[model samples]
Target: MTQQGGTWPDDSETVPLDSGSAPASFVPKSTARRAQSTRPMPQRVGAGAQSYPDTSQFPAQPVSASAQGGAYSNGAQYRQYQQNRQYPQYQQYPQNPQYQQNQQYSNGWQYQQYPQYQQVPAAAPAVAAAPKRTHTRKSPKHGFLALLMWLATAGIVCIMAIREIPFGIDGSRWVPLIAGFVPWLAIASALFLLLSLLWHRRLLAVVSLVCLIFQVVWHIGFFVPTTSLSDEAKQAVTQTDANGLPISTDKYARIMTFNTTTGKADVNAIINEVREQHVEVLCLQEMTEGFVQRLEAAGIDNVLPYHIVAELHHGDNGGCNGIWSLSPMQNVSGDLVEVDASRVAAATITLGDSQVRFVSVHPSSPTRGNQGIWGEGLSSLSSLKEYDHTYVLMGDFNATWDHANFRNILGSRFVDSSQQSGGGFHMTYPANSKIPPLIEIDHIVHDKGVVVGDMQTVELAGSDHRALLATLEAQ
Candidate 1:
């Protein structure tokens, strides 16, 4: 029979033995394995429990697993060891709960990843291309502006062409009258147009540009050379001298004046014209020594052998005024009336039986406050008693008839050969430009002479001004 404190069958009751036989003891087969792991002793009871006993064979208790608390060596360690063993078995039901949570978390992470990749698709390439197109647009603005400027320039050129055709008539009275205003009008209009364009005023630019073009075109034909009388016409127009010789009956005294703009006078046309006309007299301003020498070498020396030179700088090859006459001169003395170059010389020339006097004079221009060259020159000469003789006073007065000095000469007994012989306004000065001629500043003044015929503006062969010619009959 089983004694007290003996183990019961792990399955249920103990196995049946013979009826009288002592009940067989129940023992676990895995006890030895459990004892090895836990170091069991003979005196322990309960499930999986072990006890260590004292042994006398050794000096001290052997380091048994039970005394060491089943490999941990302390009670707390034994408890932790027990907890570690219980965890794996206890975790089985908890695994099912975690499965559902893992499924939810995995789906959420996948959803977030889908959006991040979608954001990288079409949007990134579109953003990168935008600035490149904007840069390309900016590059063509300069080209567009250049095209606009070309259009504006072409419009101006067309306008000028239209205005030139009507003004080209040879004897048009309006030729010289309108020629003078074109330059200032062009300059003013151009300035206005540029300012308007700068302000982005399109209409103003167009209007100003049109006006400027019109002014330029209007004067284009006014410069056709003046209609000169044919050689046959000139011969028919004059009466013969007492000797039955052809009289010196030219209607104008042609003279050319130049500033020369330094020493270089590049007037091939004037030089050629002078050769062609065999011009009887020539007058020049701004005669440098080099120019005089060049002119002399070129055979113009005969027309102006007696030259009165004024070096504007005392020595600087500047402001030289000189005269070239066909007739011989005598008693030539140049007295300083206002300044050294302001002087007059008298000469006697026999025109048939009548002796006529020729006086050549030049006075300072109204520059740097010298306000009265015309007045001073005329007044000084008219006051001279010797001038009572039949005289022709000729030179560049540097003042028009509008000035008191020129008017005094006109208002006094002296007659302008152009008015008495020819008709209308004879505008001179500013020789090379196409501007309207204003004020007759150069003149041939005579006293008590009958005007024989017409006045003429000679061809512009040289200098900035055309020469004048007139015929006078001494009674």
Candidate 2:
């Protein structure tokens, strides 16, 4: 077939799709420009297609014969098309302007172009590699430590479990109070871990919640206020002396008990706390001779005139117990019993028409062999009972209210001031510590004759033992 563009047709060359049409320039100048402007101009391909008038400027096609399996012989248009098909991103502009499909050419010939190739769009960006999850490889010995920690946790739980049985000695005594929060913490951790593992398990969630609620309810059932406020209010209303008249609380006494660590904490801070609270009777444990000297030197005797300090003779650090009073004290002496006795100091004070005996007892702590000593100290206090006079026993007993000896022995005769006043869970001793205290060992025990009112814990600076204050009124 003959070519309509400026040349006779070559059998090997690609013919126009509509070979009968004239070239792009054969149109009116404005129409030709409009056709050219129909789309954005492309970037330069190798060079302009050969103008037939300038056929000498044509570029040689990169041709290969058996160069590789993908190569072609004779530079066949179909073979070149096959190779060019691999890069589909590059578009091949068709011969004869696309807009000329409806237009009829008058007469002039149009030039044919060589093949052109350009990137119509850039190569699609490779998908970004997903971020890798970071993981820390624990040391082999960490497993051993974790196992030991778990064993310790289990052991504590066991001790608290049989606390009432006394199977583990001191660990079993008053330990259930410490167990209240442990199971709750463990349950919370387990629920979170289980959620990560079995998020869709409704039974597990329900069981975990039930267990948590049961533990909380169980603790509340045991440690909740045993003393009835209604009964206390009735007692307060009905309370009378031998004369059958209402006893006046206007004439009251504020007593405070604090363990001072044998002058380890700032004595000035303790003194300031006592003075700020306007304490009438102040008792201190771990009160040594040096502490007494320091106190007297610090003008404590001026504020608290009546002072009776016992001398410690137990362990090396076993300091004495002292009672400082605002009013005149009588029969003030140390409870120097046979075993674990030097830690007690007793005195008597008169408020209104009533005379109340105040005893400051600091029994041995429950550490190793000290349990027996603690028991002995407790037993000794149990013997010093007199129904004739009202008694106020206040100090660090070194035994929580949950102790068998405390409930069975001490509870047999006297009432805990905290229970009577509805003072819930006032854990004293081991103060100035970052870790929360577990149990209440410090107490203000009083005979039924003495009316116990609001009791509070005073946080003393620089001391490991918190100060306990209990309000007293005559009954």
Candidate 3:
């Protein structure tokens, strides 16, 4: 190999090189002699050996003859040399079990074996289940319907309580006038309570239940039977004849009371009803002179022969009253009551050996600013309870059991025939109007000694009120 201009020889040159005599420019002048004697020259092992620069000055490293196809021509010697040339720091680490086997490179380079990896199976795709369906009841308009029902029930209960106040204390004619419809109010309260429950309103249902309970407790008497019959009255009712028919008894009497509606009620119907029912006593209110003539023409005298009629006073407003009896009647009085004399007629009727005082009653209605006169008329009848006679009072009292004034007339001595017979809610007023009768102003009232077997109201044509009929037995 030749050096030109201080440059080293070419690596492709195949010449015996001496490392001891290197270029003077690359080696320092001071250490040149010492380096030459101590460092050995790198020698080519074969003809195919690569020419490399001598690294003897660093340290003598064993050469791999396999790198140049020298002593280890089959690669065994080169692999042994590589295994022995491991670094001291890395020698403490054990060889990986996977690398225990040797691997040959394409260029004859041996290396540690690497473990083959197996692919892991992918996870199954996630799946979700469908949700379950459930049925739910929908609330009625979010309790709005129940709220309305509760309000209605509450209003009815409140109105009924207000209307029950006596006319004398409250001084409201309208309140007392509508008092007869209290039974309907009680019914409506119960109906609203049921509706509130159906609508699923918790608060409204509770309130409506309370209102229903109050109304039922307050007005239960009107629906339930309260009358108790005496022993003599029971015997008279249960007594039968040999032919398996009820025997006619003088102790029993069929009484009917009607308001003629200022002579507008059908006279023929009234006569037919008295004849068919075998009425013993017939009391008539708003009895005009012309109405009496019509009754006579309709054969009312044949049914009830004995009679007493009151004369209508000025501004009476069809207040004239009359009474007719099948039996003989005497000791008649028209001025016994303290109110207008024309409004009431009283007489004594002979029933077998016993005598019964009968009165036809007609009071001024609390309409058209006649509240004061109406109250006075009802109040005057309170005196009748003080009398010793067993009285039978029947006609248009223009009041109901709800009226404090009318109840005062009863005064523990008299009982209404409808109540005595357990006839519930016998509405008899406004019978022939556009609206069905809502109040019972006409009634048959008798002394406590009398027992009522049956009581009912009959529809009368051409009249605003129905006729009340009662079967009474004297105890």
Q: What are the models' TM-scores?
A: 0.42, 0.53, 0.66
**Model 3 stretches astray by more than 4 angstroms:** 1-142, 163-167, 228-249
Q: Residues 1-475, candidate 1, lDDT per residue (tens digit)? A: 3333675335334333221333333323332223223343355479966544422221221123232222222233334444444433322334555433433431222223333332333323444345443322333664565456556555545434422433123112333233323344566568767866765657767877877767655433223222233454344334444543233444333333334433456445445554444444445555566776777777654434454444344622234555555545454444423333344444545454556666555555555434433335556655543454676666556554333344455555676555454254466666656764555656676774533334556535345555555444444
Local distance difference test, each candidate: 0.47, 0.58, 0.67
Q: How big is the positional error of residue 133 in model 1, measured in Å on the Cα after superposition?
A: 72
lDDT of 2 by residue, 332-353 (tens): 7776343364556788887777
- RMSD for each model, in Å, please? 22.7, 15.5, 15.7
CA deviation > 4 Å runs, candidate 2: 1-161, 166-250, 314-317, 336-341, 385-388
Tens-digit per-residue lDDT, 19-87, candidate 3? 333321232222333233434444559885644333332432222223332222123433444443442
Give each model's clash number.
Answer: 20, 1, 1
Off by over 4 Å in 1: 1-271, 302-318, 336-341, 372-374, 384-386, 450-453, 458-462
lDDT-better candidate, 1 vs 2: 2
Model 2 worst lDDT run, 10 consecutive residues = 105-114
A best-first ranking of the candidates according to their lDDT comes to 3, 2, 1
| Model 1: residue 400 alpha-carbon error in angstroms | 1.9
Prediction 1 TM-score vs. true: 0.42
